[model samples]
Target: MRGQFPRVFVLPTKLSPVELDRIEGSVAELTWDAAEAQVFVGKISRRERALFELRRLKVLTTETSQPMRDHRSGIPLVKGAKTSTRRNGTDGPHQYQDTDSAGHDEFQPLRPGHIQVVRLQWLEDSLDAGAVLSTSNYLLYEGIKVENDPQPALAPTQVSQASTDDIAHETSNRPPESSQYSAPSQRLRQGSRERRTSSGGRSIAPQRPVLVHETTSEHDLPLPPIPAFLHTTYSCQRPTPVTTPNAGFVEELKKVRELRLLEGDSIGVRAYSTSIATLAAYPHVLQSSFEVSRLPGCGLKIAELYQHWREHGSLAEAVEGSKNERLAVLKLFYDIWGVGDTTAREFYNKGWRDLDDIVEFNWGHLSRVQQIGVKFYDDFKLKIPRSEVEEIGSVILGHAQAIDGGFQMVIVGGYRRGKAQSGDVDVVLSHPDETKTLRFVEKIVRALEKSEHITHTLTLSVRNSERGQTALPWKGEGRHGSGFDTLDKALVVWKDPEHAKSPHRRVDIIITPWKTAGCAVLGWSGGTTFQRDLRRYCKAEKGLKFDSSGIRSRSDGSWMDVETDPELGPAPDMVTAEKRVFQALDLPYRPPEERCTG
Candidate 1:
């Protein structure tokens, strides 16, 4: 394979320094001088983008009218062939042809002052096939070189968003050369349940249909109007349905985000969070990088990733991150019920690679809660089905009712937000009488513990009741900090005696006064990002303090009556009370299913 490649310049755009080094190291004639290169290799997918990169690099060139062709067959390299159909000469009539470069006659020499821009995948496939593969399907541009006036280096910036604002389109302007690539007849292959990329270790889900309408221009898919609420900075103000067209991509991004958290990259975690939320709200299946770049938080880097995913059926970085040895160990510890990312790293630093390591070496040093987590590590990892979550909620309600018949409960958490399964069960319990709600969590826990339904109690707090059951004062984070909710609550482990084989599940019981029951449900129902934004919206827009306990004036400590109606009087039920909270806050009411902002 030595000296088989021509003078090549690996464009640094969209590639990390390490990745650039890896690609450059493999090329026999890697050149830093753009003028001396015969081929420009990059991850770029479009001819326009290739030209933009050349201009950014200050390489002057004019488009060539004659297309590049194969040397042996003298056939013009076709455009618009899908990458999936480009396997080595077996899959179809137009399957990729491998160009063996054992001698000089196998390859056409570059014409004087001419250059071809090819996809980075061309090099990878050539190396894999042990020959220089024909670049017909991978070629993005061909041009004649010219001298440019020397100018100061330009700051690297992507194409202007204004020019790239189109919603979705194919990679090229030319019509497909084969029927398989035609827009109208092309169908999404529902291949295997999961397919691993040729690179290995990368598992991708089934392909989704490219959402577009058949038209003559091909690049003119009408843009769906951006939802009005998407313009708002706060995710709490918008509706986020659980099911989205870009869910597979979002899931891959989440894995990367989790890796960032484990690695303690706070900025990266927040950046990925914003991008994931934006994609989760997107309604259309993406067809182009331009569509992704136009999204609120997604820019060129994310757009490039979308292009890569479309071509390879998976994100390369995400696959590698999932296989990282350090991250895998960190995730094992992070998944423990009582351990967080910080604690996970702490365990890793202590040479604890798995649960057995912690139990064998550091069992005596482990906290009681963490020890319990280690004991039931596998059991806690199991997801609780919706039916079992409901049954657990019923058992808690039944025990609460045993203490007092007036107790009311509403299942919250992921169950309320339309998840098929949940990691835990959360329920808000209230009584019509505020007096009964005071110190009520203790009674409910005691009753459940007596019945053997409650196995372990992680925490119990009654801060709100002890402080007269009022909303906590609105102080800046510097003063009050992001403390736990002031409401009375109990975190416990539960199991069903009827199903002896049932896995132990985590359950939370929240006690709220009747006046603030709505606040309790609203606070616990939405996703983590949705709740964080709700507090932010209150402080920045509404000038109030929000928590599960209640809402209060920021300037003063007086509790705000968001659950009461001015004309109709107090809310008659909890659901109405929640709606009244939305009304009082001047926010449009969002149903539980629409609060899945994650």
Candidate 2:
């Protein structure tokens, strides 16, 4: 065993289908700017050795059905138990008093229905053996000998626990029927929702299907034999307009989108987005799942969902999510800025009931941006009228011109795309001088605040793309990665100075070099799915990286020439570069107004 595992190894972990799918996409399948995640299982000793040496890889025991025991007391925690917090070093109401081998209390109370995360204490490869150990109250999973176990059986297994007749009622292992599914669902949420892309403030609401580059024909319903042209995979090929053909049906799909997003399945979210866009643009009412399957984006899964919609009138996942307390709380909490579904789950685990609860006890742990978000959640939820956005835009533009006469700003997002009401305003600014753009966010924000219009600044990030200039790189660092390529960005809470106590609105001020300003305008002017597909198209087909800042040839890692002059004068013209990006990628030039991927 020692030789086989190098005296230290990670066990062959049990994984879910979704987990496998997430880890499955690697260099060949994944996009350029996605987080690194993958999983494979086989001979335990062999596989663990390969991964353990990587140092950064995290090892976790897939959640088991019954509650597991603590290493110290060998006593199992109740189903869904929470950790006891101490005030002034005194135990809270639900404290676990289990004692250790030395007759001292020691436990890292395992909550029921959640997987136990184990930390390795020493170099040892016996993780897959049996009977977990405890150091500082850690509970280890004692692996069973799987000699030649089939792969399928290794999926989340039902852990066995001794009869809890002797256990106290408050700390029993028996769980409700709902708890059984809760574990996997929470795991899925945990695995997926941590690093999700925000899907709002993109373009006009109720987006229609995409107007493809060269396609002449449009989707005509109530006819036999669907045209081959109507079934192209690309969203750009189809004419998706703002008129929602199937609003009720699309609403159901939105729930799926919500679940996928909450689970952190960005790819899945994208998959649904394509289908949603196609269906939204569909000119005719979808009468059946068979009809849905015939559409451009729908495949087996989407077809099944359509079938469910026809027969049951709703999705099973939607029904389940509506009932899951945890999911509901997570959905509500996820609205806060800088707070993802993962952070929401952590808050739930801490017994945080509402925003006030979080504020009362957990204010310090939250990022400064998130605190601002919490303070103005209700105000941010209120939509901004086109007139209001225009006023805000004019104010920002006027402020910029005051600071620098040549600075120009355009409202992108929903307002630029002609939405009646928008969740937030996304304004893209540009200046001829790259130096001026460097600290443009700071100056503009200062100017806006002076007008008493910019109420609060949520986040300010300036690009210090000079390699090795910033602190340790975050996960999934790439030109088009998690945060996306940009010059400088400021997320702020805003309200009109005239309406002093009026509802606050979310505003994103994006400062870009004149060279890549067009792309920035194009990327930020979104119907969420439209931007997603744009990135997908650029990456998969062209092997070029496309972000707001500029396009980079994936081959050479050098930026495409969107700039006219490298000298410190006015930045390169984006009008030329915008058209050039389309030409270079061999795609039809789509004007900002036509780009909507909601």
Candidate 3:
């Protein structure tokens, strides 16, 4: 057996005071990656004890480690960290303290007769500590059990009195005892009870759902297992009751989805969105990775990643990728209202790392809209609660009516889709007389711009993208606009008039000719994928064109003037149009709330 000489194993830290202190002082940016803490400390080629003893590899005790210091600066590494005077002529100027595993000393050199198994494990603060402590899921070497102590080894007060401004404020280097790491004995070798993974790998309890394949004999087509109380893959098939049973899983996937989005991976975002929507609609607690892999939106890649989570009780990819330096910087710039994914990447390529970089050195390159985005980065990050969205909608509604009582407004987008908080508020505006609404966008901007609640005008236009016509809602190649950016709209910054520190939120007002009010509302009320599929269904299946304004017949390139024609009109409106669009495509109508697709 080839034994590696003694080397210090630096376990990656998360929410602990040790890590938080580093971040607070800007000394080290703590990595949120789950896998960083799980890498093999040393790869062993053979397990024979006689061969290993011949190599004379040394064991490292974490407790005996001395504090590390910079070579030039000679500054202490971690604050309040105890330093040892004894240094065994190490190469670096400083050395870390030597100690056993925080939870136990099970992590030791494997004997000639034993095979050491390195597995991912989760460590949690004891439940008896008044509050359920956040999970500190990590990989633990030297196989252990899956339980935790009920009492915390270290208290918050121990960390509270430390210097908030120093990275060296760690209270103790000793890790708490964990219940998950079980010392391997004779019983562990006889793997009769646990589900065995392939190739003598670590095994965890499997929670595979009994999949009852629908019509086990009839259909030649391959289909996924039907989950309990569900038959169709489309989200609209079920009520998708509003609940938070799958918040952790959903949130983890969303971070990935958002990461993909920031990196300009449109296809990846769409794929992840499908899974996100499915997980959000699921009712049961996700007990195992197998259950998540079987769901409609998930594929093998996602399934495998989730399996790691099931084994460790922590998301592996989420732990590592979310804090990736490039991705983090990209997300910061990409989230700016004016910046698109393409633009965000461009900024990154130019060495613009963050808002500060843009403001300090490259301010001249920013467009007017980007300047506004930079100015209110923090405000835009704040979500607008459902109540605040309604308040803003009411303000806009009141303004529209005052201009012309005939004009109508309907809040669409995420707010209309039942989200408790939305990144921005979408409100659709229309008037029966298409001529009167021709320039209503300009009028609304003028009116809203005067209000104390309006902080900045991000965008205002008659027809953004200014394309004459489209096959769908901006889907074709060389598309002139941000697929949904072509409609006549006003995008503004809004805040509560009373509170000076109120969050500045994004609000969009779309104006459609009253003749096509229904089509407009249908277009704007999107979960992204739903709208894309809806349009594709129109063009390919029905030979009909669909967009924000109205539907048109592809046969002769003529508007489907259902409402304007007296013979067809019972004074048709948005609701009637929405239903007819579904009918024209021979699809069951899904409500605005159920369009949580893509």
Question: Residue 579, candidate 1: how far off, in angstroms?
Answer: 1.0
lDDT of 1 by residue, 1-598 (tens): 4226766777654455446535533443454445456888876665656766676455678789976555555566554533233332211223233343333232346789988887777777676566665566566688888765444433344344212521132234323332111221121111123323222323333233233222344347666776666656577788889998988888887876776677554445655676787788787888677777667656544666677777777777578766766668878999998899878877876667788899899989988788888888888899999998998888888888888898888999999999999998999999888889888888889989888888899899888778767556656544652334778999888887677998888888999988899999999999887887787778766778798878877777567878877788766778888888888888999999988877
Clashes, model 2: 23
lDDT tens digits, residues 1-598, model 2? 1112111122212333443332222112111111111221221221122222121122233434544455455566443356542222111222222332343232222343222223222111123232222322333332222223233322222111211221132133333322221222122212222221122111111111121121123233354555443454455544555556687778898887887666544545655676687776677776555566556456444656666666687876677667755567767888887788668756765677689998999999888888988988888778899998998898888888888887877788888667789989888888876667776788888888887888888788776333311222222333343335645888988887786678988999998877677677767775776675676667656776677767777665666654444554333455555666566567677665555556
Query: Each candidate: what lDDT?
Result: 0.70, 0.54, 0.52
Candidate 3 C-alpha lDDT tens digits along 375-469: 98998898888998999999998988889998778899888878889999999988776666776888888887787667777778876324433
Name the TM-score of candidate 1.
0.64
Best model per TM-score:
1
Superposed on all Cα atoms, the candidates' RMSDs to the truth, in angstroms, are 19.3, 16.9, 21.3
Clashing pairs in 1: none
Q: Which of candidates 1 and 2 is the stronger one according to TM-score? A: 1
Q: In model 2, what is the error at residue 363, expressed in angstroms? A: 1.2
Stretches of model 2 off by over 4 angstroms after superposition: 1-232, 236-238, 263-270, 308-316, 464-483, 563-577
